[model samples]
Structure formats: structure tokens, C-alpha cells
Target: MLNRFKSVVSNVMGGLPAIPHQTEIPEDPNSLQVKFHYNRPDFLFLTSDEVELTADHISRPILVPRCVNKLPWKAGYAEVINAGKSKSNEDQATAMHFHIMAHMTETLLNKTDNQVEMTDMANTGGEFDNSLEYTYFAIFDGHAGTGAALMASNTLHKHIQERLLEVKDLLLCSNEDKMNDILKKRNMSANVNLPTKRITKDSLVKGALETAFCDMDEQIARERTTFRIKGGCTALVALFFGAKLYVANAGDCRAVIYRGEEIIPMSTDFTPVSERKRIAYLGYLQPELLHNEFTHLEFQKRVHRRDIGKKILCRDALMDGWFYKTVEEQDLKYPLIYGEGKRTRVLATIGVTRGFGDHDLKVHSSDIHIKPFLSPVPEVQVYDMTSCEHTEDDILVMGSDGLWDVMTNQDTGRIVREDLRKFSQNEDSRYTSAAQELVSKARGHLHPKGRGWRMENDRPSSGDDITAFIIPLSQLNSPSCSINTQNGHIPEKLENG
Candidate 1:
């Protein structure tokens, strides 16, 4: 059994308001210590304040000044277990593989504003190859607060699982023998009314996935209605099944795969401008004329007032509010007073271009020609399946931009590699124990009082929610080519265009 021990030593200072006095300090130390009895667990410490005391540095513990104020602190861990072990003992050689250990942690940073940071993990057991098993890992980066990131991280594993199951069902249905066997076993009539014949399992699964995203978009729209905040999140997912790896992403969240000492990016960032071109090509551009009124009538009036006839500005009209105002004012009083017309400014509201929500901006041509703002439709990308070769070990790191902000890619990879080496020298070591040590090292390097830990805004570091999971490929049991054989050879190159 793996256990975690957390000790919080908070010291209270009570003395003259402005005077420095030496008092008997409480036996409780101000620093937190996490010691493991069975395994060498990793330590992650987040503090609010730091102070200098007696030539030594100490974290100034957070104080709750108001009775109604709530101080935020949250952390938890999960343990993954074998799925089949809990169900039956039918087959010992069935390759009953699953994540045996999983955990997550969340901490509230600000109470009034509800600011928080969270990290979690998802593991879908190794494939049943009876040969070799591999693990899949992913990390989510969320902005505009932690809710979106939390939701994405918690739901992503299930989404991929369902997708894989759909794929399996499709393959099963494709085999005519399997379908006939099912009919015979269930004693179902051949002419019985079955759902649409045109509906294949593959098409239904793809449609289901698409519909799930659409429904999520609707929920996001409804949530945005209550708040005026503008921002969205990004997600990066990495899958490892057998010797093949696949990655998919939308928005800016990234996934980096490590093959030996080098790092490879598996996804692309989707920006607003890229999505705009698609929307425009879809015949969604602002109408040239509302019924019969010229869309650029106001613009033309401005040109005439400036005595520059038929001259196209060529600038992005969507962003230049001045140009829109010049046009609208010119349209209001066109031709009559070219030089001496009183100038008036009409402000138009423009929406964002790309994001998960903001349906209001997705209005079609019939809607009034409110100045064009950007939209937030995310660009989704998938990586081609590729086989990674490693001599001794391989490390995979998945994190939000928060970790990137504090440590470079090389630095993160090196730290994980060094920690792995330490465990290698000790034969009686646990991977999870080493993982915790790696996290501790990262926290130490970025802690306030630690050698390089910077102090900013009374928090440990300006780091965002940092979450990572590492896998040692060499130590894992190699399953036979069961997945490839059962699933019918996965393609070597499956890149998204």
C-alpha cells in the first residue's frame, strides 16, 4: 500500500504592531515536510508569503484577517487499479492491464476572485497483447481560470476511451461472421426493423464525437452569458498504445514527446486569423449591401468627404475603428456637405474571432453589420502515428504553459532524466516515488526561498497550473504485437493536414 504524509507547520506571530521583539517561537516549524515510510514520495509545496528571520529565510504564513474570508488549500491523490482484477478471475493470461496508480492536486489561490491552480492525471491501462504493454499520458492547459482546464483534464480520458471503443465496435461490425453470430446467439429475426442501414458503426461513432463537442460548445455559450470575461483554454492529449504514439490538440495547449534526449512537438496551436479565413469562405462575410444599401456606403461617404474617390484603404477594416467611424459618418451625411459636414462618431461592437464559446459572434449575414471583431473557433490538429525507438529509457512530459513559463523544455527534460537516473542506481525504487521526487525538484527550483525560486505577487512563482506525468519505457513489460494484430495494423503515418 502506498501512502502520503503531509505536515503543515504554521507559526503565528503576535507582538507590538510596529516593533520587532524576540519571543519564544512555537515548536512547529514554518516549513512543510513530507516524508514517506514505504516509498520516496515527491514533495510539492506552495506558499503565500516569505520573510527574513535571524539571518534565515522563512515563508510568511498566510493570515486570515477577516472572519468571513476563506483561505484556499486543496490537494488529493488517486490510485489506478487493474480493471479486470476487481471483476473476475476468468483468465490469468488475458493481459489484465490498467493504471495502478493515479493522483491529482488542486489549490485555491484567491478566495474573493476565485482564482485557483489544479493538476491531474489520466491513464488508460495498457493494451491486452499478452506481449508488451504501454501507457498513455496527457496534460491540459487552461486559461480564463481553472474551471475549463479541470473539466478538460477530467473528461479527456473518457472521451478517448469512448472513441477507441467506437473504433473497436466498427471493426467488429465490419466482420460479417461476427454480425451473423450475434444474430444467431440472440435469436433475433433477420427482417426485424433495425435502425437505418446507411448508418455504419464508424459513421455513428464519428457523429457521436462531433455531437459531443457541439453540445459542449452550447454549454460554454450558456456559461459565457453570465460573465463578461473573454478568454478560452487549450488541450493537448498524448496516447501510447503498443509501440505507436498519437497526439491531438485544439488551441494553444501543447504535447511534447521525448525520444531519448530529444523533444518533438506533436500538435499545432490554432489562432484566430486562421479560423477567420474559413468562416469567410463559408459565405459568412459581412454583406456588401443590406438588402440594397451598400455595406461600404459609410466608407464611400468618408472617401468623398476626404476627396479621395473610389480609393480602397486596403487596411483590415475589422480592426480599424477609425475607418468604420469615418464610413458611418460619411454615409449619414453624404454628398450634401463634402467639406463642412459636422463630424460624428458611431461606435460599433466587434466580437472575437476564434474560441470555444462566443456564439453571438457567429451570426450570419442577416444580422446587422456590427463592425467585425475576431472569433474564437479553435483549430484542431492530430499527429501521425509514429514508432519511437529508445535505447535505455524514454520520458514523456505533458504540462500547461504554466510550467513552460518557469522552465525551458531542455531544463524540464534534464530534471526528469536526472531523477530517473537516481532511481536506476537504486534497484529497490518505485517509479511513482521517483516521479514525486522529480516534482519536488521542480518545486524547489521554483520555490521562493530555494536557490532559484523567485518570489512574485506573494506567491511561490508566477507559475500557472503545472501538471506532468512520466513513463519509463524500458522498465515496462513488452507485450507481443497483439494490439497491431487484433486492431489490424495501425498506420505508421497518420498526420493531420
Candidate 2:
């Protein structure tokens, strides 16, 4: 019984290999003294203040006090976690700060993962710029590994800043008509007789964001071997400047804006089920991607090899119901679409359909790749926030699937509204505090005996990692007070054209 007890302890200490970055805890007495190399130092082991940020560096040209060190204001942050490795608590809320120069995503010489950065005002503006400053926020949710998230968090803003800087030139070149319209709206006439260029701010900004996402993914794939980085992550970013709000996302992570009392989505959550049509379309184009091992058809469940030549039930096109048909040899093959909604997976492995990294991902227990089906391009949502009205209660909420799994966007909005109303008299009830409240609700309550956990609704607790950012729209949109809502979603460049 003692030997069995030791075996169980060893297994528990190791956790599951399926969980990314987890390994077998050693049985050796001096194992703690051993230097176990990881892609980056565990933030769990560092104090929130000690974590890196752009503001912390003395070399920052535009030096500013760190967010954590600054006097509490309209915008703030909060986090809670029931899991992770730490000498103390499993929770970590550390954020890194970085300094950005004139619009350029400097090629990072180092490789890393699972990071966060903030900039009060990115230097992305026109020379005759109407807007003086802009703020940027993002959340990188890592899976399989953390490298992609860290790299993207570090460099994506730079790419955007650079692209936005060229807005004037692009506007002159690409869309002379639209550019003239915008200039005319400002009551400024451009020298239309001058040589016209072929790019517009619309096209430039769109191309830059999509390019940055893909570049970051490619960088992660290239550096994974050298950096020993594993896994992949979701990228959700928000760019609020002047009269416009740009929210771009490339995974299951999401961004939403709560204006007045309504819920406005800023980004789309890209999952296997949400992208079934696209996934099926790709599979149709490249049947060879199936490796003759899978079919693009949807069924009640995975079709069995022995089920060949038998009639079966399968789904047809989008929004259509499953129909009865005789199973062919192809039907007997494995399914390209597997799992169910949310848990719906691609190649029967990855749950997310769009994200960064995972370029080298192979099917579980097999060598077949799911990367061909994975993409890093983000869907860009452009919201003209300049013309929208706002209230102090209005906010922008960003969170990973962990929070969404237990709460719908509408439910979350209602909760925030109720909390703000109930705590209106509390002076300390800032946006981040509200974010903490939401995270706490999802985290649920620990058992009386300190065992499992459950939520107020009597539902199960969130089993995945959770993070939330509650940015006050008043704080961000105060001076601007401008426009609102999740407006039209525009794909990048000529892709839409």
C-alpha cells in the first residue's frame, strides 16, 4: 500500500502530459535544486511589480510611470487564478511594458512566450493629424505553448504603429477618391494634381494587422526549435485612437464593448464549429490535405471504417439539417470536422481554427499535420467610435474562452450593469474592480472543505485559465466622447475587394 501511495503521488505531481508545459515532477530529493529550463521564467514566481514593462526601462524615450506604480485612475487591472506553479498563490496578474518608437515593429532578436504589454500613446498619427494620441490594449491566450503569445504581444503593436504612420502616403496612393473624401470631410483640399499612390489607410492598416499576425506565427514556428517553444496561442487586440476603434482577433479569445447597457462584440471567437463552412471549403479544395484519412463531411459522430457502403446520416451545407445518404468509401474515412460546438475541434485535435503558432502541430499519437487547416489571419472589425455617445458606465471587456465558457456576452453585460448600479456609492468600484468581480463569478466558490468549486448558478467552475481586462470607455473615450458599437467587419486589403 505504501508503494501504491508513492505511485499515485508521483502521477499527481506530474499532472497530465496533455496539459501544455507540464512535465513529470521529479522523485529525487534534490529535484528543487535542479535547473529545469523553460521557455521563460514563470510569472507565478515573480511579484506583480517586478515583471517587465516598457515604462520600467530607463532607456524609454517617452518615459512614463508604470501602470502598476501610477496613482489609481479610471483604467486599472485585476486577475484571479486557481491554478499555476508558484511558491505562494497560483494567481498572477503581472504585466510588461514596452516603449514604441516611430511606427515600426522592430524585429525581435529574442524569442519568448506568454507576455503582456501596454502603451498609453502609440506614435501612430498623420503629420497634420487631428488626433493627438491613441491607446492600445491586447490579450494573448496561449495553448499547446506560450511562445506565440509572447512574441505577438511584444511586436504586433509596432507593426500597427508603423502602418498607421504611413496612412497619409497610403491615402494619397491607393484610394485617392476615399482619401479625398476624408480630407474633404476635414475641409482640407489635397493637391489632386500631384502624383497619386496606390495605397489607402484603410488598406494599409488592414494589411499591416493581418501581416503582423501571420508574421508573428511564422516567427514562432521558425524560432520554436531554437527557443524550445511549444504550443500556440490566441491573439485579441484593441486599438482605440481618434474617432476609430480597431479590434482584431485570430482565435477563440474575444473582445466586446459594453456601450450604455447594450453588449457590442469587438472581435469574433474563431473556433472549429464557428468556422465549419470555411474549414469544409478548404477541405473541399484540398482533398489531399485529408491524406486520404479523413472526409470533409459532418456526421452525428466520427464515421467508422467498417461502416463503409452503409447508409448514414450527415449534415449538408451551412444552416442545413443532416440528411440520410448511402455511405461511400469516403464516408467511412475519418472526419475532417470532429468534436462538438466550442469543444468542436479540427483534425480531431485542435479546438481553435485560427491562431498563431502550431505550425508544426501533428495529429495526436500520429504524424499527420493539422497546420494546413490552421490560419493566423485575424478578422478585422472597424468601429467608428468618434461619433458615438458614452457614459462613465460604458466599458470595453476583453477575456479568453475561460470566462466565456461560463458566461455569455449578454449575461456578462447584465452582471456588470447590476454590479455598477449596486456599488455606485463605492468610491473604489473602478472598471478593473468590476473585471475582478466577473472573474470571481466565473471562478466560483471553493468547497467548504477546500476541495472542488462551483458557481453561484450551481454550475461547475471554469476548468481553464481565466484573464479579463475591463477598460473604461469614459477613461479612453472621455476627451473624444466620439462614436460607438461593433460596426462593420472588414477583411484586409484586396481580399475584400
Per-residue CA lDDT of model 1 for 290-385, tens digit only, reads 222222222322343354333443223233332423233233322111111111111111112222433343112234232233232233333333
CA deviation > 4 Å runs, candidate 1: 1-136, 171-215, 218-232, 271-388, 425-462, 473-497
Clash count of each predicted structure: 26, 20
Residue 100, model 2: lDDT of 35
Residue-level lDDT of model 2, residues 377-473, one tens digit each, is 9998877765576677877887777788888999788877776776553244455457666777776765676555578877776755566777666
Candidate 2 runs further than 4 Å off: 1-73, 82-132, 166-168, 171-200, 316-321, 422-429, 449-451, 477-497
Top candidate when judged by lDDT against the true structure: 2
User: How much does candidate 2 score in TM-score?
Assistant: 0.70
Local error of candidate 1 at residue 172 (angstroms): 5.5
Candidate 2, backbone clash total: 20
The most accurate candidate by TM-score is 2
What lDDT would candidate 2 get against the real structure?
A: 0.57
- lDDT values of the candidates? 0.33, 0.57
